[model samples]
Target: MVIYGVALLAFCMLVGIILGELLGRLIGIEANIGGIGIAMLLLIFLSNYLKKSFNLGEITERGIHFWSAIYIPIVVAMAAKQNVMGALDGGFIALLAGGIAVFLSFLLIPLLSKLGNK
Candidate 1:
């Protein structure tokens, strides 16, 4: 069932958040770092595992794909929220860092595109 796939994603998200929090604490921070990324990776691995080990129906696969499709936008929204909040508190250093990151990312586009062409 599609619901089953959603349940699996939810389970992975819960586990990922817990692990991320634990990792943050281990590093002496107080946030769920990389939780979304972890959840996405876990979803990928688990879905592949299930596909190989069990006969997941079309509906379930659809459900997983649905969430996967929206995952990026969700991550972007969350990150944007964090960045806005952080930038306000972080001031000049944060703005400078963001600008550098954007510049570097833009600079890498051509190189990355060339690599992809090969």
Candidate 2:
């Protein structure tokens, strides 16, 4: 059962990667990151359906933890790079952009949710 879940996850990721690459290439965008984003979105939807259909409570939580554990070190290593500090020299702009993004999401999510309900 666990192996089946793993296999299904891998298959979904591969499909998402392929689809993202095709779409990105057609649009002249970078495929690797786009592929990952598409893969993640597809994985989320598929996981929800699989959990409901299979009664696999907390499967998503497990997957989240697993991925986080796998990626945390990679992220930390990237952040540790000397160039990362230099990149953050535009700290004020970064903060402003971050704040704007947060503010927009705060306003947008509720409005979007309401619209979705309609």
Provide backbone clash counts, one per model. 0, 0
User: To one decimal, what is the Cα RMSD in angstroms of model 1 from the true structure?
Assistant: 4.5
Query: What C-alpha lDDT does candidate 1 achieve relative to the native structure?
Result: 0.86
- lDDT of each residue in 57-79, candidate 2, tens digit only: 45545655565577878888877
Tell me the RMSD of model 2 versus the true structure. 5.0
Per-candidate TM-scores read: 0.65, 0.53
The 0-to-1 C-alpha lDDT of every candidate, in the order given, reads: 0.86, 0.73
In terms of TM-score, the best-performing candidate is 1
lDDT for residue 73 in candidate 1, whole number 0-100 = 96
Residue lDDT tens for model 1, 1-118: 9998788878999999999999899999989899878988998898788879988898887777898799899999988777567567888888899899999999999999899596
Score candidate 2 by TM-score against the native. 0.53
Residues forming the 10-long window of minimal summed lDDT in candidate 2: 56-65
Q: Could you list the CA RMSD of all candidates, in the order they appear?
A: 4.5, 5.0
- TM-score of candidate 1 to 2 decimals: 0.65
Candidate 1 off by > 4 Å: 69-100, 109-118
